[model samples]
Target: MTGPGMLTALWLTPLIGALLVVVLPSGARRAARPLALATSLLVLGLAVALTVGFDPGGDTHQFVETRPWIPAFGATYSLGVDGIALVLVLLTAGLMPLLLLAGWHDADGSAPSDEGEHDGGEHDGKRDRKKDDDEVGAAGRRAQVYPALMLATQALALVAFTSLDVLLFYVAFEAMLIPLYFLIGGFGGRVSDGVDRAAAAVRFLIYNLLGGLVMLAAVIGLYVLTARAGLGAGGAGTFDYRIITAAIGDGRLEIPPGVALLLFAGFTLAFAIKAPLWPFHTWLPGAAVAATPASAVLMMAVVDKVGTFAMLRYSLPLFPDAASTAAPVLVTLAVISIVYGGVMAIAQTDLLRLIAYASISHFGFIVLGVFARTEQSAAGSALYMVNHGIATAALFLVAAFLVRRRGTREIGRFGGVQQVAPVLAGVFLVAGLATLSLPGLAPFVSEFLVFVGTFGPYPVAAVLATSTFVLAAIYILWTYQRVMGGPVAPGLEGTPDLGLRERVVVLPLVGALLVLGFYPQPALDVIEPAVAHTVELVGGVR
Candidate 1:
């Protein structure tokens, strides 16, 4: 089980599936979704199997695989998973089948709008006619690509999580943007009533590309330094992650302080933009709101986790001393992200944007845990990644269902939703509670660990971060009250509760939130050891 083939299958199954979807003939296009779903389900099976086979107390990187990807460039196609990488990989794989299910009909033909546009009929202007035709024409083609893109995203994310070569990881990291850009632009959930989806998509791509471009330079610089240090065989530079981390961990490799600072900054900036900390976060809300709920979940829950995960995997271990010195500054930014996102979320009129901002706040907590550098904080950060994915998927996807029924995302437009759609309202409440890290839920455990861990080293920052708890309650409960409490809002009079398909999409996520909430030890057990190893590296940075 711990070999080249098992890990390769984890990513290859989906990549092959995506290619299969793309090649489907028009006549067999109807089978596209089922085929894609089957492929995701298969990938999920592989992930579960891999998880079972993983020996947490065993090697740091299990299911190890390596092949020469580029000999002259000193890059190898290497893949493996330590406990930290394992959990994130599991998170990515676990969510795909669900995301595919969540966006089940996102590519289907849209229903006619309530506006009487068809009444204009042949008398309508040419502009209206062409728009209508374009809308109709977008359906079939988009359906084929929709699942294909999702599969591609999942494939790249898996590779990113497991890659042991900096070049391999960077390639997968940047490639993820393409599918997501299209998802936001073409399959938008009608962000703020269909305004600026394309703009949002372009912004998402541009912002991430900038971050990646800077990282590319840092990567090249690090490789040259390694080659000069002769860390590779016969003085050949190597992009091997294991070789670099081992060299850096021991006294064998010493990077100049200034150069290390520059390199670490390059790496952290990319991750910050990806994690979307503060100023770099403007792109996140639009992308999240524009993409369909399932795609939004993929972006935030699965895709965004890569950014935070990379911070743990690459940033800290690769540039230990630099990270040690930078921790205070990074923690300060995390605190700012916490307070600012919480404040912004409280002010949002759009449900999706509000959720997106809330995620920014949550990511702040995760980063705080990571840089806190204690065993408790690092382990918490890893566990937080998994729990956050579940909570966000449930919260955001439930809201999507509600907004779909009401035909609007404006918060002020709804009230007393519980009277008509009790299940929807109830589930939404639980999901919201999870987001706010309410006690006895999964998120509370991780959030609590992060606070306790950070308090020992950064007490003021820890206290400041506590502000999110109150802010979260305000936004989560107030939104719930406005949308689901009091007298029913106009046009929601007979709103239906969760349908079979919608329930299928939501119930499992809700259940996962509860199950992990009550008992998160199993996840923590697997995450702690890897975190301890990483802490050892950072701790000895001097």
Candidate 2:
């Protein structure tokens, strides 16, 4: 009970676990699975404790931990939880263990092969068996890396969210790209279908790294501005977000509005690429399609949230005047992403890719709400992040299960699934409905809030954005009809329903979605103060 505080432990737990996993011996693969799971669970428990112990009545960083990491550069090891970081942190913790469990496989469980047969007469069987063995090996390798890197990514993201110092936050923010690069390239590259997984990985890295490099420049610029502010004669600029925030507030650090726009553009490019708004989203569908269900879930549910989170945390607060001036343009992009993602999703034959595009559409809502600059919209954006994570995780998990059984994500490859896997189909229905923002579900409340707040300020954009629902419903129901309603596919006549392990992994997410849908007040209550504070910080620019 008297262990490390929430923020400290959250940062260290996964780092320690990741290091242990790397050093683990050859025979320790089995242990690696459980160790990773335990570490993730422990982090989750700490997050829950933090949530329970959180003071909903007040809005400030809680469970604070700060230490001088580099005194000369003005960087520090600083961390604390506000509502936005807190919810995202908890969601990260919740999903890492599930990724591990879904990917778990024993050595003996590998597919058997006939390559060792002694006669030419067995050639056909031999070829078939080798295919099976290769499939097993590929899956095994994926299982090992996906979950481990996911935890590492979570660790980096948590650090980014909690860090009070600008340089530290920037480092953490950029460091996350490394694991995710591997997640998409290394983990996704190995999947058996579609264009080369490596190709998809390369595309993902090239686009994201380009965005990251731009952010690096902005970070240095901000540091220079901060360092020049205080010391009388000659002072080296510092890269501390809190110090910079204070400097900006006092009007001591005056950046040319054009320079501010340039820096904002850098940061915006990075987050937008990650959020995958409109034109920049081409890498996403391929990455998701090539990735395993577990990997897709982590990428869509947790990793993408980093972009939205950075926009809210860094961009708007650091460059409020610029953000306000650019809101109209950004909102336009959000509207296009909404419709474009939905339309493209409807055309995808592949289940994984469809879900990926759908997420693009959903993310448009989050961006719209943030830029709308209303308390209600900001609060809704915050809640939508949590809701999206849960709904997406559920959808991807079910999609993964279906792919394993049918050996394809093609809508044409599946049919009458509900008759065979009633439970799975039911869960899929729930996830799909949540995506459509059906009344009584998590997305409904959040999406409604986004529209309500944005419509007042950007009515046309809001109305155009609402078309996403029609588009979303079209894709979701189309998928359902193609995959679940007709007579069962040839090889899937007796497909197994969700196993106990799969159920154990998925049920919690389902319950979470339902609970949040009904009583989102807890998350909303905690975020209101932070949202208001953020709005006020940006409002001062005018």
Candidate 3:
């Protein structure tokens, strides 16, 4: 039998973990990391179980749960997962534990602590100076708050991914911001080059909130349309996705072209800002540069997927005609993002900012595939989301390790790192290769599928976007050579290599990319049906 309440359990586990973290005595704060890790592990187990139980051939949502939540507004506490949602959920669940492990020591260093109480005569003046530095680090780190916010964000993300009610999705979408805002504003990375973490957080919040407000208006408009068409629950407008999708699909509800396009723009704009497409993506570099590595992974690799996910789940399916009409413009923007992000990445001295730009380029490929509207490309786009999470997480985590070692993110600060930390160098190289879509890596298959699929319908755009491959190699390998290949820089001789814990944290991400690279069929099998259905909804070809 299908596991009942499995979906509820998936999200609730993390929410409860956050609550536990909050209630734990301050002295017990050390327990927070283990608690968060255990909670994430549980969620991962549930996600894997859900995946194994899922019938890949089935077209409908699995493990469905629904209850009246805001019936006055026709919203429900609904949750379910199709293949698309399942994979993204799996990505989120899988990454959380790794991120926690990667940040373990960093978190400890970040926690507030009394470093001044060392035993008398045991601490020398030099040791006292080091102790003072440690204290500063601890003062900057919000160990308990970081993990708690991460869990909270995960809960909201799961809700956004699984919710079948449009209103519920919006609520989860907006709710996710609170924890992330604090994470960025409160526990952000070392400020460098005048990039203020608080300002970055504020910018992120303003842009997203504006997009959300626009989307809220569109949601209301959709509710009114369905109501006037007598297409929802009790013939009143409903926010139920099933009812709305059915009404639109069956022609029971009709929306004017102008109104449909307007609504489409509302949704698309919001998703784009979150996706951080081209011009809209201005907030991401600063945010990514300012936030902690764990926070960056959560935001970029997992949370940002929501934007593109919404586009595929709601935008294209709900407004096919508008999507079709706007495909050229969207595709153009995607191409620009691809080129612009890559070129900008090549110019970045900050490693985190470089990764952020790389993500913009990668997101361009995903958006291109989604708007391409073919089954293969769309499925590739879905798979790309998962692979990007794996690859980007690996890159960011490794970079975080490097930064922690060197005490700087400036690319110019180090040289010949590989000579000392060969294993660390090796892992960083693999992650960089994956980002560039090197053959035999997980990202290649997905990137290839995207190109092949896009070429069939939008060859010119495809050709232009392909230039990103060259740019990617330039930035990735050039950075590698400069940072790791040159003679060992002075004062860098003692930089420790990847320890057992760091290796454990990174190996899974690298292993995932390798395994999925050679054997993508299993993931593709799960994604194909959902993609086919989506294409059908958009009146696109297989």
Candidate 4:
């Protein structure tokens, strides 16, 4: 049944699985992976059903559920999905199962065994010793913890995407960090000794919490203002997003210029750090490089979208005047991020870190589309969010397969991977091309829309940002050539091609990218109405 409660069920299914995993005996903890996979699959099914039932022609949110959450503050346990939310929810659901499979061995606390070690006379002993050390390190990690945390993170992301109440959205936003901190801190590949997982986790938590506290203050201030304006005179200052939005749009809630700017700053700052544009992005590369591929996918592909999503959903609509005032500054930063992230990606020797930088650049495009303030750009931004998650997840999953084989993420560690594993190499090539926005790939469609839409109004900014395409090609192609070309690395001759499980993990993403590339109409059909509505809301204030 496509009822209002379906959204809650979509997120809660995984949450319940996490709790079930928690109560499982230590001996049965291995079951946690399968349990998580099943739960994620169920959620995916529900999301697909929701999409089928969704009314694309409608401008309003569908399948909405609202209940009094905190009557004193006018916050409600409200949830709804428009086209933008629906697409992102689909992206989130689609990626989870693949992440689980890609990470199967890593999460289960197993390292590749040394059963077939190289027998070169002098180097054999050293290679065997290194393998032994790796196995020991892998065994020390808890099996249940990683999968459980992943499921929990998925649930929080769903809530964040669907919540309509600003307060509820904030709570979901902040609550997300808790599971993510543990995931990054507890499970992941190693970084240098000086920057342990704990340190990465702490840095991420501190940065996000600082943003959250600022946003909390802004939310409170808006509530008080609405109450004082007699917008919700009967009870606590209404945090009802619609009431506040209408009041702001109609010029009924008269905020002083100074106060509006402050409120706008608070919201933008939080999203900027989360979108991790330019200077605020220092934490991402370290976290992504150190995280296990599965963790990295969840963090970058799904979780980070919340930042740009919030910028579009709340920042622009809630404070249109402030957004207009700040658009130039925001666009400039986005252009810088696009170029900067691309250059950084070219210089990275670590595959995981390279992906991290690539995402920074991609997010730059998404944010630019958001602030460009046109229907096409806004829809493209939403589509970019979905497309990016798909493409990036494929890249991470394929890279994880390579790392599992070689036990290293260093780009220099391998040469001529195609000679040993042509299928894996092919998969990597497709993902890389997708990242660089190859035509007939999903990313190209959305990116083209963004440029077309932005160029009409911000021609200079759009032209500057287009330089990213060249930089992207250089980094993606160069990395591929370095890692997959030339003679096979000496020890990698025995490296196996992608097995059935790995293929299963990657094919769906590839298929989706291809299908969307050729026919993005379905997605655009869903996204257009929401974009039009947002444009209308912002226009009302103007």
lDDT of each candidate versus the true structure:
0.89, 0.81, 0.88, 0.87
- Clashes (backbone N, CA, C under 3 Å), per candidate, total 1, 3, 1, 0
**TM-score, cand. 1 vs. native:** 0.95
Best by TM-score: 1
Model 2's lDDT to the true fold? 0.81
Order of quality (lDDT): 1, 3, 4, 2
Give a tens-digit lDDT track for model 4, residues 1-542.
79768988988999999888767775676677788899899999999999999998864789898888887777888889999999999999999999988888675545323244556666677897887676654553356667888999999999999998899999989999999998888777554322367778889999999999999999998888988887764745787777788888788888887888899989989999898888789889888866778888999999999999999999998888888888889999999999999999999988878989999999999999999999988988999999999999999789878977998788999999999999999999999999999999999999998998899878999999999889999999998898999999878999999999999999999999999999999999999889888988877211
Cα lDDT tens digits for candidate 2, 434-495: 99999888988899988988988899998999998899999999999888888887888889
Model 3, runs deviating above 4 Å: 109-141, 192-195
- lDDT per residue (tens digit) for residues 27-95 in model 1: 787888999999999888888888888877988888888888888878898998898888888888888
**Residue pairs clashing, model 2:** 166-241, 227-237, 227-238
Which lDDT value does model 1 have at 378? 86
